[model samples]
Target: MSKLKFFVFVLFMIISVSEIRSQIVINEIMYAPLDANNEWFEIYNNGITPVNLQNWKWKDATSTIRTITTQSIILSANSYLIICQDSNKLKIQFPGINGIISTNFMECPE
Candidate 1:
């Protein structure tokens, strides 16, 4: 009975953590783009509530992490925000994209 209770507690904790993490998701990634300095990734909000992105972070496979210090980055439900290397290059490459966010998270290799 004690073992079962422990298992249930662990399960509950896992579910709660997952729920907290379900608000945001990586929607798209454009790695190795033909244009110079055009690497980017898009984040989408999966939850029904708007998520304020102040101090929210993005990390690569390495230990490097970049935080969004911009206040009021409130992502509405089912919306996308892109984290990009170069806005000018991306704009020249893809003209009609409406939601392009530029950041200095990582520089594209020459």
Candidate 2:
């Protein structure tokens, strides 16, 4: 209500927001069905902030795993992040029961 109180409140909000940390959460995981040339994994950032995926990775039932340190990616505030076997050729499959969820925009080759 008072000037001092408002300033304190604003400062607290800024600090609290900035202090928050983002966790790399795997919201969904699936294998591409189109020809199965490569597998893909989807990650979601369910935090109130953003995160850099420079040194990220993923694993499955097998011993073979994946690391995304070379990939330059940053998940938005509230969006799904895609990781494909072939970043240049393969398409990012959305979290779907099958292959009926992705927009197929990047699926088609130019």
Candidate 3:
């Protein structure tokens, strides 16, 4: 095979492996402030089935874990859910957003 063809094959293999490994993937994260107090992370349901986030948790690089305990959240297949610091603030910033789905996370210990 040509060098270009070989490169494409390797890239395709890597991406296929990644997709297989990721059941529920973190699609986007807003670390820095979009405004003064807007911080959020988006999770994507990459699997074919819906996922229940009833007791799911998120942990940062520092191992700070926060569980979702407020309400039961179910994310459908090929859908996205944005977990935010303040859903109200997020809605205010993006007025066109029809609905906001979120839960409060406990403050991580320093």
Candidate 4:
């Protein structure tokens, strides 16, 4: 009887973890060497559905913000965005009905 209870508990934990994965899809990631001078990162969501960025995290050698809140952007499927400390250098890739995607780089401030 005890063995059967243990098997059921293990199965339940496995199923619970699997459900969480379907919600968030980390589509793409880019890392620029900051060398403690600057901190920046870009995370794209390629999920078929829109996900609220609230409570999501981006981490580096320095800090972590609880969320990415900029213009309340919503990334549609197959689209991408740039999240960085220096938005001035790289133009953010936003989705139009039809447009060419583009990006550039910023030299880290010394």
lDDT of 3 at 74: 76
Which regions of candidate 1 fall more than 4 Å away from where they truly are?
A: 1-18, 34-36, 106-110
lDDT of 1 at 55: 68
Q: Which candidate should be chosen as best, given TM-score against the real structure?
A: 1
Give the CA lDDT, 0 to 100, for residue 83 in model 3: 80
For candidate 1, write residues 9-103 as lDDT tens digits.
99999997787679899888887767647788888998888778776776665667776545567788888888787888878877878777676
- Candidate lDDT values, in order: 0.77, 0.54, 0.73, 0.47
Candidates 2 and 3 compared: the better one by TM-score is 3
lDDT of 2 by residue, 82-110 (tens): 66555434434323432121212132111
Residue ranges of candidate 4 with Cα displaced over 4 Å: 1-39, 62-66, 92-110
> In model 2, how large is the Cα lDDT of residue 47?
75
Clashing pairs in 3: none
Candidate 4: tens digits of C-alpha lDDT, residues 1-105: 999999999999898666544545544455555442233454445556665553345433454333455234555655555555544333333323231222222
Q: 27, model 1: CA deviation in Å?
A: 1.2
In the range 1-110, model 3's lDDT, one tens digit per residue, is 69999999999999976764476888887887747358788888889877777767668656888775446777888888888768888888778764256566764444
Clash counts for the predictions, in order: 0, 0, 0, 0
Could you tell me which 10 consecutive residues in candidate 2 have the lowest summed lDDT? 101-110
Candidate 3's TM-score reads: 0.66
Winning model by lDDT: 1
